[model samples]
Target: MRQYQAVEETGMSINKKIRHIENTIVLSPSFKQAIAMIRECHERSKLTTEPKCMLLIGNTGYGKTTIANHYVGQYARVVSKDGTTVPVFYSMIPSNATIKGLACRLLEDLGDPLYDRGTTINMTSRLCRLIKECKVELIILDEFQHLIDRDSDRVLRSTADWLKDVLNRTKVPIVLMGMPNANSILTVNPQLMRRFANICELKAFNWNPVKERDDFLRFLIMIEKATFFPQPSILHSNEIALRIFCATKGVVSYIKKLISKAAEIAYVKNLDRVTTEALALAYNDELALSNTMSNPFLVDHENLNIPSLEQSFHNSSDAARHGGKRRVAEILRR
Candidate 1:
């Protein structure tokens, strides 16, 4: 009975920590800039006769979708012809996205019927009419990387051209979200590429020695508070924190998982605080998991040290010129 109680307590404590860490999520500086740029473009697009499009390119787990979600919630708005306002429609391109599937998804978001006979053209026309009717300021398409994943490249190209025509007709800002290869897909379609003038690229987490230490401490504080079972205590080990930065390579997604996994292991072992021994076991487990699955995004560093800001921000000079707009152009040009 006592053993069971201990296990129960540990489980409860671990769950709390996980929840706390999730709730106290932090956006890196680059991500914050991207969100701000998107918000600004959405606002400007609503005021202008021409649509202002933005293409968000980033790596997986780098908060590309999260930033888009935030902008959709905060900035995206539908303006009525008579000046009434409401939230704009948001949709994501599916894993097995086809021209038909993407059209259906957009129509569904606009509360239109998803019946048969709506070819990519029909659906695009319908969507443009809806956008005009609803005065949708922005059409945010997440997972736009799926554009290249259509059954055939021809279908994908057709979808791209159709999307460009819709935008040309509706004059509504379009935000495309995807990972690295998304640029290649967009560039292949000249019309689509023209609409996507503003490119916001996001890199994985860059550990700012100046800011990371504080961020690391704050993260540990949240972890401590979250670990309720076995009595919460602070992590006094700097070495553990260093290992964390190394394991995650400062990428927020991987970092979140590693920390959460460490807490989980500590809970299972009935440890109050995450000890180095427990951490080592967690590392081995994570490494094993990574071998079986492509999970972690750590970089090659001596003893797993985080990369310097210089390495992370190699494109800083280029990014500063257009304040990020040119960054997308750079990618498209490449």
Candidate 2:
């Protein structure tokens, strides 16, 4: 096969091959828009007295963190006479994060070695000083929903107030990213909600509207270009596209995982290209899909049941609640 010949000629190692496949990042339409929005907000924050904050909400594995990381990379740390200046700072909210814990995490990200030793007040004071010292213009908090406890109203209000206090003191734009439930933290605090007036939602792809389907196919082509197979795989074909959509429920992350696994399996088996059998095997092996469900790739397009496919999607979402591995297993069981 062409791919096999190319691999042999180059003598590429398996580790390098896997890294090449894993490192591909497609700049989809939504991702591009998010980058633009972040830049605009960052620029506006520099000139305005009031911070222009944004809430970025989406399902898990919907590229929310990836977009934030991309934006941060654009303004990586700059060396100057004074010290290192980080234009964009990023941190993750610890699960059930408290005001003190949040403060310590921010301090740690700011390069403070003694962050964990400080009390809440001491940490907040140091955090404010470091923010100015480091010249940080924007802060991104991923998994921001963890700031509030669902069971305690007192904890929720205190944490929300702490965030507002930080914004008032720093006047730096903050982007909070997390699952859709992250909105609840804002809904409970009107002042905080009003401050973060600019809200962005990252949605998964759907087969509706011819354009969406066409765009997904284009995305597949992009993925195929990055993926190294023994031979060319017609991933953009209508049959494969429909089957992939059914299997992944239009989630880009899931699609990437499925393709990567299938590619790896094809490479190991010395196959010319990924076939329906390889895809089915990948689905079972990587996703732990239950044998009870029909394999999308193996079934006829016309015979595919919409309700059953949707149930698979629902199961995937439900499984996400528990964790990644469990979620996959749960979906297959359904």
Candidate 3:
């Protein structure tokens, strides 16, 4: 029997299966490691005089947010007659965020009634008080890269200093996460960097058989187990696997997108199973790369120009530099 299989043979309504696909999280090894590291920092902060901070850097679409959310869920808050105890607090750093703006956001998440009405110092004080009052052991701030100057990519010194003060006050483990460029935020702030000196980098999944293929296959199987697929184990087959790898370039979010869309197509059309054509339609509809020779599902593997795995990461700057649809297209054409 397949692992974690739900009902047998289309037990769910077509819509439910499609919905389940979006919820399915395949916990690959790297994902588990990153979560473990974050948990350790959370636990460590409990005993330290100084707060422990960690920086998690990964490419876009690599599931950093998912990890943050999963970590929060794992250590969910408890409520009782004594009071509500929030073990973990998660918030996203807004684009062009000010220290006051950021503090208000955190305060809002912590249930402060007047989230937007305080001065910068007042809000930070209230935010820190709430963090301690609620007994929050960990604070997770996502989108850390937005802390840098977009033009120069330099860390915003004033905001960085403000964040350092919050950690000093709260004395709770804090996880800062963003795309790989977020490292630029740290490089410019030595003090802040030292505070979060222990860093974890999550790289994209590689397709080379010698290094990462087995893990990728296992990931697909795990996704299979999480849902009642019309057919099973078809994703890990060599042919479909190759198509998936080429289509998604081993990015977790893209893989999920392809699978979810293909499953949606299969169910809507009453297909016996997810087929290359379904994946082709899914890829075209969702990825916006259809009709071009680059669509992995539409072309012969031999004919498709798969870019170097290292070049697979998509970013705005890279896209602008390379021009057109994206760098992947440029890489494929070479």
Candidate 4:
């Protein structure tokens, strides 16, 4: 008789290198527009009198960073229609930054340091001069939401005004990346809003069957295949994928972690394919606050202490139907 590896006991290995990039979704038209504009700014750096500025707004894990990275990569190599060359410099705005600190970061990115000794105003003047001299065109400020923590609204308003002033003085494009809430912040400040005349919002993945599913799944499978190097594994069926979608609610970061954990379980059991059993086991094993793996009353597989995991398929199926919402509520209330 052949022996079956207990689903509860499986251990799967995962490729960490691949997991890092799994969170990035394919670029949509909105994302492409941001890329196009950023490139235009870089390509027109030497010629344009007025600088271009864009503000990118999005929820977490919505590929804001990835899109920004992609923009930098493309713009760094921009070539003119007549085969002329342009240099694109990239700089990150430091978290919890003041105007002087931001100027320092920009100076550092340009391979120099502001040596002028005086108040913040003096430093700002020196930095502006350097930016003009260097002909820097594009400035990307990531995590710009931190500026809101200023104790005085005046400070915040001044920061916004100063940034607007810098852009006008330098004639350089600026891209601000931050959480969704940052959009409201920018809208409230007239100066900031004017600078961000062209706004782009990045949203989470939408599994609309018409256009996204193909690229989305390919992106997913690519991560899975690359993460589990040497020994490739396939999902037992689409059902497993659906379960994953339901469990993670399409959060790319959580999806990778759940799948990686499942693969680790499968690897431990020496299984070549990831089974529903392994997936369930992995789901149950996840200790994060967001996990919807197994219902509280549903019981775990025979060996696990989760009573709900031990419940019969009929009850488990019912739990799956109600989505274990009641059970989860009960657990939370406790």
- Cα lDDT of model 1 by residue, 59-86, tens digit: 8888877777776677445445565343
> What TM-score fits each model?
0.71, 0.87, 0.86, 0.67
Residue 165's lDDT within candidate 1 is: 74
C-alpha lDDT (0 to 100) for residue 88 of candidate 3: 90
Off by over 4 Å in 3: 1-9, 290-293, 309-334
Off by over 4 Å in 4: 1-34, 44-48, 74-86, 114-117, 150-155, 208-210, 228-237, 264-269, 277-287, 291-334
Question: In model 1, which regions exceed 4 Å deviation?
Answer: 1-17, 75-86, 115-119, 150-155, 207-238, 268-270, 291-334
lDDT of 4 at 25: 48
RMSD of each: 9.6, 7.3, 6.8, 8.9
Candidate 4 per-residue lDDT over residues 46-165, each given as its tens digit? 576666677787777666777777866764533455442324566666656677777777666665544434677776787677666655567777777766654543335556677888
Clashing pairs in 3: none
Instruction: List candidate 2 stretches off by more than 4 Å.
Output: 1-3, 79-81, 150-155, 290-292, 305-334
Instruction: Give residue 104's error in model 4 in angstroms.
Output: 3.2
> Candidate 3: worst 10 consecutive residues by lDDT?
1-10
Error of 1 at 33 (Å): 1.1
Q: Report every candidate's CA lDDT.
A: 0.64, 0.78, 0.78, 0.59
Alpha-carbon lDDT of model 2: 0.78
Model 1 compared with the native: what TM-score? 0.71
Kindly provide the TM-score of model 4 when superposed on the true structure, using C-alpha atoms: 0.67
Worst 10 residues of 4 by lDDT: 1-10
